[model samples]
Target: MTILQTMVSVMLAAILTDNYVLSKFMGICPFLGVSKKLSSSLGMGAAVIFVMACAAAVTYPVYQLLVAFDLAYLQTVAFILIIALFVQLVEIVMRKLLPPLYKALGVYLPLITTNCAVLGVTLNNIDDGYSFGLSVWNAVCVGMGFTLSLIIFAGVRSKLENADIPETFKGIPATLIAASIVSLSFSAFSGMI
Candidate 1:
């Protein structure tokens, strides 16, 4: 297949068929933490998309070179540094370009710096033997998938604020139940790729 076809396939697969969070359960913290409101969820998701894409773009080439040199054991450390610097770059850009958005998403952005989902996408890209372009595309689509799930959850959570759910299944319980249904619904896409 052409590079374009490969990129598109990896991206579509990550977003629809095997989302990092819903399908693989890589980053559940922000999935549950910042999803209380749609606005914040969107912000968080966007930040993730940017970070993951850049990280994948950079790390795919770097890690593969390291592996070729028999330094594969350094993947974790190298990936950490790469993710941190990439997120820092994003933070700087956001702070300069959109101060209000930076302020609004201040805490969440830092939290995402260490998000497994970001690093997981990078690692997955390497693990799957995708080319650099394919890694970036997959990271982007996976980030979009995360955003989609978070936004929907946020909307549901907001409405459920006044719900009369049973006392035994209130708060996190309700959230988990809701997420389970979402996960199950997303499960249908497992075969699409």
Candidate 2:
């Protein structure tokens, strides 16, 4: 495949078949927590996209440096520190410029620092042996996948608000069921690449 084909395939795989949230299930905490409202979900998704992309950009070279120093085992620790720094930067910027979104995200904004999906993208880039550009692209695509899942799930959850249901299936139970169905739907894309 050519470079363009490779990039497109990577983007499609990340945003569809191998979604971190819906398929790999890497970052479910914020996926479920902030998805209750469309507005909050969008805010959270944007923050995640920012952090994941920035983390990937920083971590790729940092990982190379670690490998050079024969400290590869410290990649996880180094990646986490880098991700945390970016998340903190995002938090500070959002808090100052977008107070409403900042308030909307609440504790979940901080949770981005610990989001495995962000870390996973950085680590997976190294594992997949992608060049710097591909790694960043993969991170952005993964973040888009995360956002897509959140938006779809948020829509599903919103519809559940007025749906009449058995008492046993209300609240969290209903949300889980809906999420499972949404996840199942994504399975159809498994071999599309």
Candidate 3:
């Protein structure tokens, strides 16, 4: 497929069917933590997408090169370091050029390093043995998945915030129930892959 087509597929896959937080369950904390508010969750989701795309774009080639050197076993550590450094670079750039976004996303940006979704996508790319284009595509898609889930979760939580949910089904309990449903709802997309 053309690069454009690949990009589109990746974007759709990430944002729609195979969502990271809902389907893969890679990022539950921020998905739940920042999701109490729609705007914050959106902010966090956007940040994750950016970081995921960047991580995949850079890590794919590095992973390929590392494999070439017969050092495939180092992928875990290498990916972690690469993602951490990239998040740092993004923090620096955001602080200098976009102070507002930095203020909004600064706290969460550091947290991205430990987010399993980001690392999961990196490792997933290697496991799938995707080409440079496809690896990056999947990574972006996975991030989109994360973003989509966060957006939906935020919306759900916002509406639920006003309701008088049962004692057992309040707060995180309700949130978890909602996520479970979302996960089940999105599982229909697995056939597409």
Task: State every prediction's TM-score relative to the real structure.
Answer: 0.90, 0.91, 0.88
| Per-model CA lDDT versus the true structure | 0.85, 0.89, 0.82
lDDT winner among the candidates? 2
Cα lDDT tens digits, model 1, 1-193, are: 8877777777777777887888899789999998998888988988888778888888987887898999999999999998888778778888999999788766677888779998888887888887676777788899998998889889888888898999999889988888898889889887777
Please tell me which model should have the higher lDDT, number 2 or number 3.
2
Ranking by TM-score: 2, 1, 3
lDDT of 3 by residue, 1-193 (tens): 8888767877777766667777667888888788887778877878888898889899988987998999989999999999989999999999999999899888889889889989998888878677887876787677667777788777877777788889877767887887888788788777674
Stronger candidate by TM-score (2 vs 3): 2
Q: Which ten residues in a row have the lowest lDDT in candidate 2?
A: 101-110
Q: Which wins on TM-score, candidate 1 or candidate 3?
A: 1
Tell me how far the alpha carbon of residue 73 in candidate 2 is from the true structure, in angstroms, after superposition.
Answer: 0.7
Error of 3 at 102 (Å): 1.8
Q: How close is candidate 3 to the true structure, as a TM-score?
A: 0.88
User: What stretches of model 2 exceed 4 Å from their correct place?
Assistant: 93-108
| Deviation in Å, model 1, residue 7 alpha carbon | 3.4
